[model samples]
Target chain A: MAADVDVAAAAQAEAAAPLKTPLHARHVALGARMVPFAGYDMPVQYPTGILTEHNWTREKAGLFDVSHMGQAFLIGPDHETTARALEALIPADILNLAPGKQRYSQLLNEEGGILDDLMVSRSLDEDEDGALYLVVNAACKTQDYAHIEARLPANVKLVRAEHRGLIALQGPAAEQALAAIAPEAAAMGFMSQRTIRVAGIKANVSRSGYTGEDGYEISAAASRIGEIWDTLLLDESVKPIGLGARDSLRLEAGLCLYGHDIDTTTSPVEAGLTWSIQKRRREEGGFPGAARIQRELAEGPARIRVGLLPEGRAPAREGAEIATPEGETVGTVTSGGFGPTLNAPCAMGYVARAHAAPGTRLDLIVRGRNLPATVAPMPFVPNRYKR
Target chain B: MAETRYTKDHEYIRIEGDTGIVGITDYAQGQLGDVVFVELPSIGKSVTKGGEAAVVESVKAASEVYAPVSGEVVEVNSELEGAPGTVNEDPAGKGWFVKLKLKDPAELEGLMSEGEYQNYVKTL
Candidate 1:
């Protein structure tokens, strides 16, 4: 099936093939509405459409080709030393991480603002000598790699896994979809990690997802990933989903998209992600911008992340102005859309800490009209992660 | 025998006597990919030619349907409220938007014919 895919050496393959992922042909054949994203042409949805795809994943399983996301590793002599080195750069608790386990963490700048949120998994080994597997966002991969390489010490090494492709099988039926090839995957708990064979292809499968569903993320060699993807999709319950659905799913799940919800101008505390930072990181203060984070944690941040529910049906799109009761411009919408699952328009933005509480009334200046709004709790739909 | 006409925005209308049947063209529904929700005009509501008469919201974007000729709304496709997907499935058939009593049938003279609409969509 992959005869046309000529896999040269890893370095040459990326430059020669122009970075087409394993599902490229399948997407075209299935009549997927493809769009360019982060240098890769990926399907935003199939002929069935984005709305159907979004609802399908919410009710069944949605298979997504996330190969554009950067996957790499950090290798060192032992786990403790590696963890300590990693803690200096990110806000996650790598030192407390157990073998065969993973943690969601943010790579932060020196100012305690988020650079990118990423997944870090400790290799399943007792000797503590293993690589730290990482999956970074597709759009920020280039800058993230450079940032990591620039900060690493002499003992720690960063290596890019260029030949690998990543796929996310998310939603209610994810476990059943993978049980055919990896039975252990079905038994895996949330945030757990393990190496497994997918349709006989060597892969690292993690029980995690961004869509607020029970799911698994599989990373495998690029040449063999197409086989695994095709095999998983053979089940009638599984359908190919796209970025458009992916965004809606994440938004409904209350998960934040990097550039839209969090950026260098916003800190984790202000973004309502202070829970992800370890207690030790908050106290001992070894990582970058620890002092700022600790102070914000104590005194509270000035502006806070809050959900906005527009009174009318018209969507409050990004950059919409947020105002107080007397028409005082208080905040701006960072991300906004009509959440399919919620069946209503929802938005998220930063507002002054005093007005950040749920039920706080606000007005959105949308299209020259003052749209009445209220601060609602996020994830608009409750996340059903298999913990 | 009368002429069927289309607009750049994708609505198509067939004029018969003093009345006309309005709906989105096959090209419009095809470009929209799939329809999810549709907003129709109230019966007896008077609308002007080229004014927003209805709205068809596909999974991708919401688009306004403009009146082909100034007319009074006589009938609407109530079935669309429950099955807007009909627009994507059969835009020119079961997805007909509305039937209106034309104020000036002469406005029909300004519309593009079926052949012209087909050619127009090709350029897009």
Candidate 2:
């Protein structure tokens, strides 16, 4: 009876109308196919289709409306106080993060499992030295904010930037396209952040993106974001991309999708994210799940995430079982799909340490058929990030 | 002239004497997005009405194309292995998935005519 009630509640939530982003009208005007994503009515693909958009992003600049992602500011009395407050939750070295620099990390539970993956950036202005800009997954923001708020000291506060909308311009030509509007953005290196005026609108521009391409993520007032999007589109090198290409591009880049790849059950060490944990946190052991993470760092994790290249055209989708040639189950695919850049099937999954090496042969069981696959290195397409 | 019939699931069967050429409709291909791979039924295999006949994979997901009526597969489109995008480019022409020997010609009467199928698609 209780299970049925829970199911009904879930159905009711699913039936609720999705919210629209600031650029929703632009997507509809461009004839994009809309789909429900992270509680927002998002464009899955434009009229030109996912293939064209994926290729366009690789060769040119592709503009993406990422307004649904949660943006907030962590405010405290000073940089040290703010960084230490955030470090108590995540494993990254926030205190050492230079001004105008961004770092990627995960909010971990007490048991070493990932709560959510996020990007943290230190403020560039000296007047705002105590503020840290945070970007988190759309689905987990509410809970993440509540969790952080409950644990934070009275001096530090979490301020949600509800009136802001975010957009990402990514690809090899992204720098040139953005430079046309904000010339200062051209000098910013990868993982750097700065506040700039984009066509007379105050915006926070970051030289970072999930796609392993040179790109910028610009955040501005929700009302003015549409103007920035329109101004960027004025560049012939920039084309509007949708979530479909976003998933494919990130998968090809070997980046993790929050809910699919890293979840509450997965740890940063097991997800190949130890690099994000700096030396101070690893040695000082002050953050949540530090013991488990440090132990997993010294003694390797039992299962580690690795890239899978399935032989042939058939894609091995998520939930497909990974097995030995003799049919022994070794792991399961967490994210799998057709990689447009590779022109082949690509996947990432957690496999036993023994079977995680590149060039290792494995089988992906799909539809009761054993498809041959190889354990390959990630970023199936080479990353083109500017230094 | 060959007669064409479409199932509610979007599979189409074009009757050519004893042989029936089968493929998904253009609307189905569009809904599936960019076709990346196609898994065709083997020749000489038997298929039942509404049974899984072939697999179509797009960049987004995979879907099954069911047989419109019971039949024995006579030939398959091997060219789709190398050029799966043809399924999106020419869904009705060269992109036909398979040709099957009809088990019963009368079964065609139960399926929708091209005009009726177009009308049905409008209601969706």
Candidate 3:
């Protein structure tokens, strides 16, 4: 769930030839167990394992080599053209996205289904007022670029930067260690973005992460990312984490994974991502799927994503069915696993609106047997993102 | 002498008389990463060789521990019910999934000896 949902395709890609990230050598040096993720050979976990890494990030700092995620830029003549071009594809208030600030939104189809979830950051550079930096899920990068390119005008170009390496340093101790390299990064407010020199290499740093924690994601030249990575590790508080803990951390934060939690068949409204739609977009209704999204926003989705707390230690894996106690199938789990922080099994899935409220009793059909569970408010663990 | 044998699926059984102590190999535990929970069969449950005898859940995924030999479950490892991580820490000792009374000790012949298993693992 940390990467692509179709792991079979990733496995076939690996068999053909697994693409290694810029930090592959470093991951191997740190004794990481690598697996094919989103067409790249990614570290699933380090020698310390996932639980320790998950808890370490909560108590200390955990470094993640997410260079496999796609980085790109949208170009136009000015902020209005750029934001407007992007708005045509996504349903976020891009025009209002202040410079140096980043916003989360989903790429939707005409049917109101999510094409992909991404982060759009208005460039902080005064000279580049027309450019927007975008980070998209790796597996969807190809189609996503094509999707945007087909829609935008000739002046608004899509620049896919496959040569950039993205690294996320997340945790409570992230600032304490990052300050040693780029002290300016420590001052950036949550969701703020800026370009700074990290370890003598110019990089784009964002005060945001998927981990629902205080963190920074540094985007640098693919070649120099290794240098930036090594420099950050010099601080003893940092430990290398991998996709395993990354998945658990994000799940505990109640964030949706693009391919699993939100897919082409799922709408933002059903995925509980109505928040990413700003008031203007909701009312103006210009973007793709605006009609259905606006209607769903007002009437509420028939089936909605909710958090499930399984009564015991058993994990309800993805694809598990959810049902009422007497045995009427209601929904299915999309992302379900153990929360290392809570030391309990928590899952996120779609259930009927009637069974979606917190404290609603339900049963998860795990391995064909019904297990007792209850709908719970998520961040199954409290979000510690530095506001 | 207590005889130890293994299945190609990475299950192991240490046979003492008609009693077999069953668990996964260290190689399996290594591949499984961190063990989060273990679902053991109930006492008196009869299992056939190659059938699911227990379920092991790791942080990454879940796998079924297959029975290496036909047997009736005698005692289950309660320690795993509380601390499933014991499987990763000490897979052979306290991590044994269940103790079973062999219904037919001859089923052990289909399993590999320690030396054969080590060589088999090398081939993998």
Top TM-score model: 3
Best-first order by TM-score: 3, 2, 1
lDDT of 2 at A77: 98
Q: Model 2, A22: alpha-carbon shift in Å?
A: 0.3
How accurate locally is residue B51 in candidate 1, as Cα lDDT from 0 to 100? 86
lDDT against true structure, model 1: 0.82
| lDDT scores of the candidates, listed in order | 0.82, 0.90, 0.89
Query: Per-residue alpha-carbon lDDT of model 3 for A48-123, expressed as tens digits?
Result: 8988999999999899998888899998999999999999999999999999999999999999999999999987
- Give the best candidate by lDDT: 2
TM-score for all models, in order of appearance:
0.85, 0.97, 0.97
Q: Each prediction's DockQ?
A: 0.17, 0.38, 0.43
Per-residue error for A268 in candidate 3, Å, reads 0.6
On a 0 to 1 DockQ scale, where is model 1? 0.17
Summarize candidate 2's per-residue lDDT along A148-196 as a digit string, tens digits.
Answer: 9999999999999999999999998999988888999999999999999
**CAPRI band of model 3?**
acceptable
Q: What ranking emerges by DockQ with the best candidate at the front? A: 3, 2, 1
Per-residue lDDT of candidate 1, residues B68-110 (tens digit)? 8899999999999877779888877899999999998888888
Q: What value of lDDT does candidate 3 attain over all alpha carbons?
A: 0.89
Pairs clashing within candidate 3: none
Isolated chain A: TM-score per model? 0.94, 0.96, 0.97
